[model samples]
Target: MKRHITGLFVLSALLTIMACKKSVEVLTPSGSDETYKVPQGNNDYDNTIVDYYNKYGTYMLYKFTEKDVYWTPTGWKKPTLPNGTWTTGAEVEASDSAYINAQLNLIKNKWFGFYTDKFLKKFLPAKIMLCKKVDSVFTNYVFTPTFTAVKGTKKVAAFYNYDNIQVNYGDATVNSMTAAEQRLFIYKVNLIFMQSIYARGLNAPTAEFANSADYNTAMTTYAQAYGKGIIIGYSNITAQSDWNAFITAMVTYSAPQLNASVAITDQTAAGILNTTKDPSGQIKRRYNMVRNYFINEYGVDLQLVGNATRGL
Candidate 1:
């Protein structure tokens, strides 16, 4: 997927932009603290984001103008400072509202609705920018897909670029992506959330599935069947990579998909990779660990969520 594990150095500065190099009160596009009603619509992305703002308030990053903004899920378009150096918004046009809302609704249902509903936590990013175009920010949009506020005690921000990916349908979202695109998108999202501060509470299993003999066998079978790309790949060496790998397992790969992906050379290999045949008695140890974490910590069942998301 042309991906890497650590994105901290790349996107953390995004939060700085959200803070405007200093903390500012939650200012609406009008740059006023007065009550700005969240725009109402059937769009899940807009509604969920508005709901977030209603409860917690949104910090206006930039009063952007020029480029088409992706609404609230990405970043500021062309932010200017207060001293006439620049200003925040370009002024919202009533005519474009319908089209913008349509695109945003597609994005929300495709990928973000999952987070709004499944990411049950209080430590959400204070600022969210759904950029109108990829180049609206200081850096190139390709390298910055989803930036989240996750570093230090400072404020947090999450951004999405609308032009980052291509689509055939007039309506596009996570569901509209190709099989491979969907997988990569899900993987990236998992990594983004997994590396965030909210995911810091996740503790890798030490005993439940860590018996030396059993782990050794699992690793051996995994490597032998999958040829080392599945478990211990390039993006899985970081401190949180293990958890990332686990999330990838739970969300991206189902039990049957995993078992079938294995190259069955022998009964032992087959047994180790197969949940029905595993002698360790845990068909999907990695998946089980992650599933338990969500259920135990967030009261959300990963199996149901995964199945629904993956169309399992």
Candidate 2:
């Protein structure tokens, strides 16, 4: 009886050791991770927020064409002033609609259709917003293998935490309201999409890809655009409050109104003659308020980027 009992104890100890070894193996690094391609099935990568945006984000961006032309009075008019110059609302709407439709078609037929699979089905029905401008917009499409969504919401808050790396045209400026506003518009839209990804119970991908020096550089470059690039009208970002305010205003108010065809000429001319706030400059405050908040709340060490020139 005593011998049998001892053998049983030994067997239990060995089993426990084997189980622990298996657990350790499971937790070990997946051997110098690489961008593992999906075999077009139910892979986790296929369902990631990044992939969803890659396939559908552009389509969401293109939808703004409808909202864009409508937002500007002259946008819906036809163009007779010049071939490129917008003249009438009808023509403007038609022209823009054509381009937008084509963009939508590409997303639906080329991007999303190409990648449909079981994984995607689990996370369909997402909201997407398009920023008409901003260089880092491409980040919407880049794939990241690992990410965690907010605990309870489908909004991807990870972007708020990711290092504010900037990318192409590092710290550059734009020439016109139409151009500058377009970027602001795009930024707002992207945030909406981020929210959608979060709502789906998926977190935006984390900076885990930072393990790769190349990807790290890419992320840094992508972030720099927002931190250093021309901020359309605002001058600097000093705190998190600034970022929140800017994002709120951009998403809720500014984005829907800034479009290509509006001839603020009437207002612009009035400003030139009266020496008043460049009507554009008046709206500039909404932007300034955001930058100020960033400086105060976020602690961006670098000087803020602004319109007209690179002012603090």
Candidate 3:
């Protein structure tokens, strides 16, 4: 997917996928006089994943959607400042927790199916609480105040503030989801995990491009074939765009699976893109950066991830 196919697919799926993602049962906030609703069943997941989560992190249930995290003893402890006010950065929810557990289970299962490496398995964030909302105050913080920046940042025997990958369960929930729903959910999780955190590390691993001439030439060739609009800001933000190109390519296995989002006017250039043709090998150069980063950094064969992700 040296092209923008995954980006396009992800964008396309967002507005519609949430509509079908199921609904959540809101619980009464703590201290409310109203009778408390019964908490949902915790989705039992893979034992290895459950053990990793229980031993390393806490699953929290909050009071509302998009509210500040106020954790209870059953969950992780909510961080308190000197003033006794809670840390204000995290978007969260509960049945939501069950749904989240299911989502995490899906991801865990996919990881086992695809990746032998434990990098993501060991570090993936599990929502510590299941609640209605989390206050949004930590926009300025490096992490959203869900978990620590790294797994061991707060490293006390299972008592550190680990970072969280916020899964806002306000709009929908997944419990015993259908195969299709699970497939789509896993796809989105993989995409977000890849773009937001996973790929960011790969951004600066290699040196910046040696020269802009080769880049410019490639852009010109690309513009001529795909139209100037496609590469309009190509030169202005090559690195960021390069990462996107890498993600797209790394996610999709081939042109056949890329759907029709990619509009290639020049059939020859399209062939070159698919590696059926390459006048100077310029098109593949950008893609190689992403592929090489994975191989060199984690010693991972990214093709395995692509194959597994694509299988879903």
Q: lDDT scores for all predictions? A: 0.40, 0.31, 0.42
lDDT of 1 by residue, 97-174 (tens): 334444445445544555544353343343333432222122112225565322121111122333212111122232
How does residue 126 of candidate 3 score in lDDT?
Answer: 45
Comparing 1 and 3 by TM-score, which wins?
3
Tens-digit lDDT track of model 3 for 1-312 = 745998888878996676555432354446763222223234453343346545545343333332223343345435434343445333333324335555455545743344445444444444433333333432222356573332111111011123344443322443445564444444544554555444334344245332322334455345442332222133554445545545554553434443223434443222334432333445456446556666675565555554554453
Cα lDDT of candidate 2 equals: 0.31
lDDT of 2 at 150: 19
Worst 10 residues of 3 by lDDT: 151-160
**What order do candidates take by TM-score, descending?**
3, 1, 2
lDDT of 2 by residue, 13-117 (tens): 999999999998888586653322222234342344345456533112222243432232223321233432333222111113223333333334322332234
For model 3, the superposed segments whose C-alpha errors exceed 4 Å read 1-50, 53-92, 96-101, 111-118, 121-163, 168-176, 198-202, 208-213, 216-221, 224-235, 252-272, 275-279, 304-312
Which regions of candidate 2 deviate over 4 angstroms?
1-4, 16-20, 23-181, 184-190, 193-247, 250-312
